[model samples]
Target: MATLPNPLPSLATSGLDLPPGTLVDTTLDGTWHEPLLWYADGPPADLRAWSRLRAAGRPLGLLPVLVTGGRRDQWPEEWDLCPDAASYPGDHDADEVLAGYWTEYAADEVAPEDTGPGTDGTGPDADGSEGPGPWPGLAPVPAREAAEDADTAAAGLAGVITADADEWLGGARTALVPARRSADIPAAIGWSGPMNHENDVARLCAVLRSWEDRYDARVVVLGFDTMIVSVGRPPGTIEEARALAAEHYAFCPDNIDQSPPYDLDAYAEKAVLNQEAWSFWWD
Candidate 1:
C-alpha cells in the first residue's frame, strides 16, 4: 500500500511555536449555576475550562477523562471507545474517547518536559514542597482504564485529556493528525460574535454572578464570551451547575441553541481533520 502521508506533524519533533495567546490557570472550589464556557482564543488554559470544572471534588491525579457519545442502542456503560474495556461502547463513554485522543495529541505535540515539574508558569521551585516533580509524560488510557488508575494512584495529581463538545474518534486515523491547524486562523481572527458561537453574553454573566456567590474561589478572567474561575476540592451540587450555564447566557444572549439536535461527534471529527484552531476553544 502506498504509504499514507504523515497524518500530521509531531508536536514533540516539530519546531512549531504556540501562536501568541492568553494563558490562565485557576482553581474551582465550589458550585456554579452554569459554568460551562468556551472561547475562540484567549489563553491556552481557557481551552481547559471544562477540565478544571470536572476536576472539582476530584483528587489531584493523572486521570484522563474521555469524551464519547451515547447512542440509543448503547446504554450508559456499553460505549466501545476503548478496545479492551467492556468489550463495547456506551453512551457515557464519549467523554472517555475524546479524552484519550487528547493524550495522543499532547504526546505528539507538547514536550514531555514542558508539562512536568518546572514547566507551568507557576515558576520552578514554586510549589514549595517538591522533589523530582510531576510525571514527565502522560499516558493516554481509556476512560475506564484511567478511572481505575486514578483510584489506584493516591496523589490526586490527575490531568485532563478531553475534547471540546464536537470531537471525532478515528482511532489510528488520529495518530498522525494534530489537534489544531493554522489554515483556519483567518476565520477565527477578529471576533464578531459571542464565545462558543453562542449569542447569549448576558446569560454567561448571570451564571458567573451566581457561581461567585455560591463558591469561595476567585473568578480571575472573564472575556466577552469566556470565563476563568477558581475553586477548591469540594464543589457544589448539580443545581448550581445549571445556574452557571444560565449565567453564560448573560454574556452572549444568543448563546442558547434552538436548532434541531446535531451530530457533535461528526463535527469534532471534521475539526480535527482540518487542523484548525477551534473557534469554540480560541479567544
Candidate 2:
C-alpha cells in the first residue's frame, strides 16, 4: 500500500515533547516491517491528554487516537490487526463503496422479530422509504450552524470515554498513528476492527475522509471491533438526519440492524440527530 513516510522510527530522538510510550509493530500475521503506532504506557488519566498528544503529533504527521483494551484486556497487540490486507484510502471512492454496501444489504427482509417499537411489522418507514427501496444516495453536507471545533469536540469526547470507560472504552490509552490526517488513522495502523463488515478497512477510511470533509468528524476511539467518531456538525432536522442515517447504515449496518428501533428513522433520531459523537460496534 502507498503511504506517507513513517516518522515513528525517529520519534525517540526527534526531540519532540512526548510521554513514555511503546512503538507497536505486531500484527495478525507477524511483526510488521515498520512500526504502525506508538501508544502511551499508561491509561489516559488526564482529560487534556488527547488534545495534548494530538498537538504534539500534528507537526510530525502522526495523528492521535484513543485505543481501548476493554474489560477483557484485549489491547491493540492482541486485536489480530492485519495491516497487510489494507489498500490505500485514496484508491477507493466513498460514494461507490457506500452505494455498493447499500445495494448489498438494504434489501434483506427485516425479520418480524427484528422489528422495533413504533415500527410496523412491514411497511414504509417515517421517511416514506423502506430498505427495499433504491439507495438514498449521499446526504448533502449540513450547514455548520451548531458546530463545534472538530478537535475540541474530539477532546471532549475523549474526556467522556476516559470518565465512563470500562465496558467498551474505559481502557482508553492515547496512541499516535503515522498518517496525513485523522480520518486515515485506521488504515494507517492496519486496524482490523471492522474486518467482519469489510475486509479492507481503507475502503471505510475513504468514507471517513468524506465525513471529515462534510461533517468535520474525526476518528476518536477504536476498540477491537468498535469505533467512536466525534462529529462537529450534526444534522439539524429529522429530514437531514434520516438522509445521513442511510449513510451510517451503509457504513455499518449494525448501527441500525442490531440496534434498538431496528429502522432508519429511530436510529437517526437517537444516534445521528444533533449528536456530537457516534459509536459503532461489529456484532
Candidate 3:
C-alpha cells in the first residue's frame, strides 16, 4: 500500500508538542522497520484531547484515530498488526467489492419466501423486506441535507467516545497514525478486526471511502473487531434506511445476522434511521 514517509520516528526530536506517549512498531512479524503509530500512555479523559491531537498532528501528516482494546484488555501492541499484509484502499472499487461479498455470502442465505412483497399488496414482508436481488445496488444518498459538516461531526463523536473511554473502549487510548484519509486508518495500521470475515481490510475501507463521499462519514473509533463511524448525513425515513441496510449487510453480515432483531428491516429501523453514529462488528 502507498504510504507517506513515517514521521513517528522523529516525533520526539521534531519538537512537536505532545503528551507522553509510546511509539508502537510491534507487529505479527516481530518489530517493524519504522514506528507505525504513537499512542498516549494515559487515557485521554479530556473531551478536547482529540481536537488537540488533530490540530497538532495534521500538519505532520498524522491523523487521529481512537483505538479500543475491546474485552480482551489488549492494546495496539497485542493486536497483532501486519502492515505488510494490507493493500491500498484506493486500489479496489467499492461497489465491486461489496457485490462480490454479497454474491458469496448473501446469495444463498436470502430465500425468495423471506423477502417478497407483503401478501396484502403493500411492500416488504412482515419479517423484513429484501431488495430485488441478492446484491441490491448501493443505497442512494440521503435526500435530506446533512446536519453538520463531516469533520465537525467526527470531532463531536470522538469527544463523546473519549469522555466515556473506559465504558466504551475498555480504556483504549488516542493514537496518531500516518494515514491519507480517515477511511484508510485501519488499513494503514493493518488492523485485522474483520479478519474473520475479510482478510483484506482495505476492500472494506474502499466501501468506507465511498461512504465518506456520499454520506459524509468519518471513521471515529476502532476496537479489536468493531468500528464506529460518524455520519454527517443519515437516512431520514424507514424507506431510506431499508435501502442503506443492504449495504450494511454486505459490509458486515454479523451486525444483522448475529445480533438481535435479526432482520434487515429491524436492523435498519433501529440502527440506521436518523442515526449519526454507525457501529459494525464482525463475528
Q: Which candidate wins on lDDT?
A: 3
Model 1, 48-155: lDDT tens digits are 433343343123111112222212222112211111111111122322332332333333332233233322111133466322222222111111212222122211
TM-score of 1: 0.20
Per-residue lDDT of candidate 2, residues 20-103 (tens digit): 788999999999999999888888768888888778788888888998887677888888888999899999999899989876
What lDDT tens digits, residue by residue, belong to model 3 across residues 1-283?
7898988888988667777888989998899888888898888868888888887888888889888888887888987787888899999999899888877766555434436542111234345655335456788888999988888899999999888887877876889999868999989888888988898889999999999998899998887788999999998988788888878878998887788867767778899999999999987
> What's every prediction's RMSD, in angstroms?
23.8, 3.7, 3.7
Which candidate number has the best TM-score?
3
- If scored against the real structure, what TM-score would every candidate get? 0.20, 0.90, 0.91
Quantify all predictions' global Cα lDDT against the true fold.
0.23, 0.81, 0.82
Off by over 4 Å in 1: 1-210, 216-235, 253-255, 258-283
Q: What is the overall TM-score of model 3 with all chains considered together? A: 0.91
lDDT of 1 at 260: 16
